[model samples]
Target: MEKIILIGDSGHAKVIEDCIRSQGGSVIAKLDDRYQERFYEEHLIKGPIALIDDLLIDDVKIVISIGSNHIRKSIVERLNIADEKYATIIHNRAIVCNSVKVDYGTVIMPGVIVNADASIGCHSIINSNSVIEHDCVVENFTHISPGAILTGNVKVGQGSHVGAGATVIPGIDIGSWTTIGAGSSVISNIESNVTAVGIPAKVIKREGL
Candidate 1:
């Protein structure tokens, strides 16, 4: 079992912790900016993010475990450790095919179905019950939220968020830093740095560069 150090403590982290436990790993420490330096639980330590290097050691891997794609990517940049020290967590219940490519720091939550030749990139999150169909390419730091579905040959760019219950049809390309609103049906390509909502997914806002 891996001795893990988790960074972040939101509700998302709770699920990530469960995913870790399901993989036979133990979360020995949790670091977040909100907590004071103390033992929050028996055999567990809780402290600020500044305590990261002090707590990290050999045989202990780290997980950002945060829900925000931008913040997760920011922290990933801040972490001085080698990529090999980052942990990729997949819930035991996820049905990932043999041809799927899962990179470091990614998390595949319970009930996720990643079909053949799907490529999940580094630091990405495939949240609970999400279905990533064949040849889907999810880039780094992306989050496919709960109940989201990406059909065959879909390409999701880096730092994107497919909101809960969203559906991107086959061959759709979602650009980087984009957000597809919850329950939206994306039938066409969504460009970068925009928020799209409604059925057929129209861009409602373009984020500043």
Candidate 2:
């Protein structure tokens, strides 16, 4: 069995734990910033996030199961581990095409569909029931939330978050560190570091505003 360590303990981490078990992997530890170093359960141990490097032993793989894109990026940078040490988790029920390329530390949840030629970058999340059409580019540290749809050729930049149930039209470009509001329809290009909401997904707020 593959030994793994999860870097979160929220509901998101719980789902990831199940996913790992489905692939016949064992999660030996779960690290979180909120918890002290101790056993949380008979089969689980909670540890401080700062001690991640020390806990990476016995060829155990790592996954940052946090739902927030910013938090995932920060944790990854702090760990500074090699690419091969990160785990790429794909739920057994996810329908990913053979032509698709998924980088390390990316998680593809159950009910996801990644069509041909799609590229998902490192530490990104393709959440449950999300549809990534052909030729889409989902960059590093991004999250395509549950039920979101990225139509063909959409390019979501690094650290972006496509909110749940949001739909982006074909050939759209969503910039880096941006957020698309839940259930919104993105009809045009979204700029970086902004929050876009509503039917047309306009930038309602920029970073620090």
Candidate 3:
């Protein structure tokens, strides 16, 4: 079994730990800037984020268990680890089709369904029970939150967040760095760096405006 080092120690971390275990991998340690002691019922707390370099070994894989796309990207960049050293975890309970392609460092949580021809980019999160339909393209660092649904041919850009339970209709394009509010229904295209909310999703806030 491969030994993994996980970053972060919160609820999201716990879920990622379970996903790792389900895949026949063991979490040797959890590193977080906050807690100094053992993180809950899991492995020993391996001090702060600074300890990552010290703990890294030749065979040990690393994964960022944080939920925030920005923070996850930041941690990966800060560590400067090779792409091969990053672990891509998919819970055993996830239903990913044979044609789906998931890149490195991505996490497919329990109950997630990724259909045929869908491509999920590096370090993205397909959270619990989320559905990525056929031909969907989820770019790097994006988060498809728990229970979110992306219909066929939908495109979710880099660093975007589709909030929990949000639904994007077929062929909809969600731009980079955008936020789709929880439970919203997106029927049209959303531009970059904006927050879209409500039924048929409308831009409520744009970056710097």
Angstrom error of the Cα, residue 180, model 3: value is: 0.3
Pairs of colliding residues, candidate 3: none
lDDT of 1 by residue, 68-138 (tens): 99999899888877999999999999999999999999999999999999999999999999999999999
TM-score of each: 0.97, 0.96, 0.95
Q: In terms of TM-score, which candidate is strongest? A: 1
Model 3 scores a TM of 0.95
Which regions of candidate 2 deviate over 4 angstroms? Answer: none
Ranking of all predicted structures according to TM-score, beginning with the best and ending with the worst: 1, 2, 3
Q: List the residue pairs that clash in candidate 1.
A: none
lDDT of 3 at 143: 94
**Deviation in Å, model 1, residue 45 alpha carbon:** 0.8
**Candidate 2 collision pairs:** none
The deviation in Å at residue 54 for candidate 1 is 2.0
lDDT of 3: 0.91
lDDT of 3 by residue, 39-109 (tens): 44433646677777777878998888888999998988888989999898999999999999999999899
